[model samples]
Target: MAELPIEIALDDERATQRLGQDLALALRPGDCLALRGDLGAGKSTLARALIRCIAADPGLEVPSPTFTLVQSYDLRIPIAHFDLYRIADPDELVELGLDEALGDGAVLIEWPEHAGDALPSGRILIEIDEGPEDSRKVRLNGPDQAMQRIRRSLAIRAFLGAAGHDDADRQFLQGDASTRTYEAVTTAGGERLILMDAPKRLIGPVLRDGKRYAQIAHVAEDIRPFVAIGSFLRDNGFRAPEILARDLDTGFLLLEDLGRGGILDDQGLPVTARWEAAIDCLVALHRTDVPRHITIQDGTAHTIPPFDREAMLIEVDLYLSWYLPHKLGAEPSPRLREKFHAGWNGLIDRLENASKSLVLRDFHSPNILWQADRAGIERIGLIDFQDAMIGPAAYDVASLVQDARVAVEPVLRDRLVARYEHARRRDPDFDPVPFREALAIMECQRATKILGIFVRLKKRDGKPGYLRHLPRIEAYLRRTLAHPVLHPLHDCYTEAGITPSES
Candidate 1:
């Protein structure tokens, strides 16, 4: 196994810019170049040349879209060049329409500051610097494995004079998260890929010990409890994009890309069409034979510590801190706070003890993908499952039914919950009354946790937009609280300064 040698050299500015221009010809759909440099540092010069080479329209003039923001051109490949010098805010990027450019084609930008949080992980971060006299120094950083597959493609095309696709021009994809990404592999050949960041620094150690930590094919029998459900889902007719490549040392995983079109909340499609697939996927997950091999033994996410009791308490705290404060404009008194905690703790115990199964903690709309044209997901994806534990079967069901990011029709929710229960047991003493009660409990459990997570995203992760979903999640919590089963807990939340949030 030989690693490709990276050449480090101080090339003249002219040569470096020329090399960039040449690289432009290699661009194709799904490629991005982040031009990094100070003012008048030649970032624009290289971007301009790359655009010209890509558009093949010598008439295509490169104008800095300082005021207009982003200039899109129909080139040999679609090219979007954005200038963010004037844009002080990332939200402005959405208004300027750079969101549409990140994934469609090759994007060359003079200033990417406007891209803000929406930059794709598949972007190439190009650092351009002013070198001596007329020279510049250029660097290329990639997010994809930078597989020899890509470098090899270049080498083979060079070795044999055959050309089907031009590598000179490329397109790029960016998401709304600050995952800091760039990819080198081409998905046109039908490869699936997913990029995940270590959500917390606590994950670094686990990735090294040889568990299926997304970064490696390595499996941890010690951590087998965490994977039983995932392995079960894969064994069933359901498909989880198999782990393709991993570097456990770095905690980086290369997954099968489910495609950009996978829907969490794409509004272009009808709700009936989307949830129809979602419901089926949930059914499959719930129907699977839950592994009894789960060990609540020492050093697991489920031993009732940070990932469970303490972690769950942390979630309840989110509700106490943000949603309640935002709606009430202040924190409740200590007595009221204790009441909320006691009620919340009781709720956790009820769910944690009620029929333990593999609970995909974050199984919801954003984590789901509509892979087919009809009912049921062509492939159900499980993200944010690192916090998984053998717990209530209704945990994920409550997640899908009471999604906070968007509205889920009550009709759909009712039908889906019924489906999940049916799949779990043909007639395990069906009780709609208690079921609804359980659902409300679960939804509150989720909302309480998300309130904390969203606040954490803003307070700690530097992502403020997540706060937007707070009100909606608060509304979901309210609905669940209104149920007769959850009335006591709901009262506790209200007493704790959680305003009656419904929207």
Candidate 2:
């Protein structure tokens, strides 16, 4: 069924521009937004504001395209502004490159009626009309999906406004493998903050006793886990972002901006000192006694879940469920799947005697920020830890040393592992034998799961960028399989025709 049209009242020119800014944040490439209104209905004003906001330049000159008919900006998500009032023929849309404009980026078309049926179907149509006093009424008609995004953008604007940041400018930061989106917000006073727009989303098919894949995997269904974990980290002297303002029910959070310095150098290679600091942060974190139950700001308790055997098995199943199917173009036979499961079960069984700690599931380069001016582990800023679990400390150690996003060379990888082991050995009871064995097993498990995840990210999530890391993760898997404990998994890989290259 089609969605009903939405009507918004803009009290003045400022509100009209605010709506434009909101739309700017919501736009994606290939989007066409048609503006229908009489002259002086604030169409041009809204377009100009939107273009300027997307460019992140308040003073950007967005001249009226009334005479030229079309104006293009080479900003992020390239924009084409068109005023079709002067067009003599519908075929002129081709000459004006409307198709090409939309192929590369989004387009804002004014006097769209002049183009007749030349406008693309499914384009977001906005009708601006005169209203009481100096106000304008805007009616938006579009696909239900697009309208949902528009509603979200408007809600974010309202969220900012309620936080006394009505005048703030929002710039797109990044979106990860999940449904969450982030924005870099600059307040009127020039204070910078990060906005986490994480609306609750249920993921995947109902698998196993009426639970979804995310539920079985212990993935966060809402922003509450993030709030609880971040608060716990902050209280424990970790540099997790300070929540400046929050609307937990709405899944909007305004957080203190952690600086952009990362462990990777300008050349995209790991820096030794910075990487050491990150390791130190992990060591310090593991040494602390983290409680299973954390109280959020709302006085609600969040109990951290353990990365139990079931979760591990479900995660390992990703290899059989996604990666192997993609590689072979068919699901493996039941016997092979059982062998694969048995291999992983045997490996995880060894971790039963491993040291348990707060495992930051993603502790690699992308999530670790470097704060040079600070001393000790305080120099390390933790950004992504919402999916943290109570698991083997070795799991996090392996995650870092094998850093999936970038190549952590064999020498550096070994040195880092040794560094972590050395730091933990301060306690006389700490045993290196079990820890090393657990690290190898965890590395293999993480690498195997990621092979499926990266493939799934490409095939299922429309993100092909992750595919580039497959070879590296496979190489890490091979390296770990050299350990005697993972020999059975190696044989399983060989049988499945995914024999990791001997390193």
Candidate 3:
């Protein structure tokens, strides 16, 4: 690939540091940066800034590696900082573990000239020089791919600047199981916000009626749904993040920083009070008459799709397509497949006629934040609802009581169900028997679908961590399918040789 060179002028130390931080966003494991500059140049300063940004630690102490020759950091990705000034010969590089460092993680090397022919190809080269008025000038040269990443990083910097947060310190935040990424931005004035980098969803292969799986599954393809849903939630006095600024075209949103107070405690167990608050939030949501269609500022109406039979069937079929083959290493026979479909179809028939509400499909622990200062349901901050659908209210209740990632103790789950039932029973139209049945059916369906999804994540996406939750989901499925209404599903599982006891 051809190399592209770009020049940047830094008027002060902050500008140089900002450039380093921006560059850090584009870096990945195995990438290398060769720093070239004269004595007393800003090479160490820029390297320190880059390391700290990648580590998400602003106050990290990064001493010059002048004496040690090399210093490594355990950032989100491992990084090695090498000051090669002390090296007498290029052959000495191997003795300093440079080759091993380059293989394991990214490296930032100062005085690349001393390395001679030991320098690798495709590495980014940055040269710093003294400029007029005590300023600094930086020239970057790298391969096409690296240059492209740098361009994107620069674009993000410009976007933040245009949003009136020019000097915000960016720190990488945990992303969801989607293409979306996030960064926590802290401004110069100490204001914190979340920067969402959700690019437009790529259209996948046509599934049904020429619609992609994303469309058929009711996944949000852009930021419009999130903005509309968030507005709707806030309008109804819920604790959705307040939008600070947005570039809809770029699919970037600057939102209020909902603090990291999750429903789970440090031991990965549920907090009773927080869980109760979450139940209250769901009760309030289900009681409200949410419109299927909502109008945003542009006057275009965004409609929440129904959890129709086709969508539900496609979701449940993930088990046959991914989980069974991947986990059990056995394909279901035609008879078993037919029975599975027949069972789910029968359950779907019951759900189609049930009372419907806004179903936040993933109303579990990870997506919920606890805000103690707030009162009642408002204290439960909601996130990850862009894929919300109009579905049976019991679906969300099942999701909450039988969380996929964490274990909700059997007793606590029963208590939550009782609390939810009590709240819903207050409505004149609510029927206890049907609600309980629907919750059980939905629980079984969710577990079945997640079994496939977790397997798919391991096989297709190379994420094996999700596999650990399979046993938990299996246990939930067994408990739910024990309901008399799910007898057909239990039979199907037995025929397919996937009994919960084996899992």
276-342, model 3: which lDDT tens digit per residue? 8899999899888888799876677899899888888888988898887875578977987998899
Runs of candidate 3 with Cα error greater than 4 angstroms are 1-6, 88-92, 116-120, 141-145, 491-503
Candidate with top lDDT is 2
Prediction 1 TM-score vs. true: 0.60
Q: Highest TM-score among the candidates is held by which one?
A: 2
lDDT of each: 0.57, 0.88, 0.87
Instruction: Rank candidates by TM-score, best first.
Output: 2, 3, 1
lDDT of 1 by residue, 243-262 (tens): 44443333333445565445
lDDT of 2 by residue, 201-263 (tens): 898889898999888888888889999999888888998999988988888999999889999
RMSD values for the candidates in order, in angstroms, are: 10.9, 2.1, 2.5
Clashes of each: 38, 0, 0
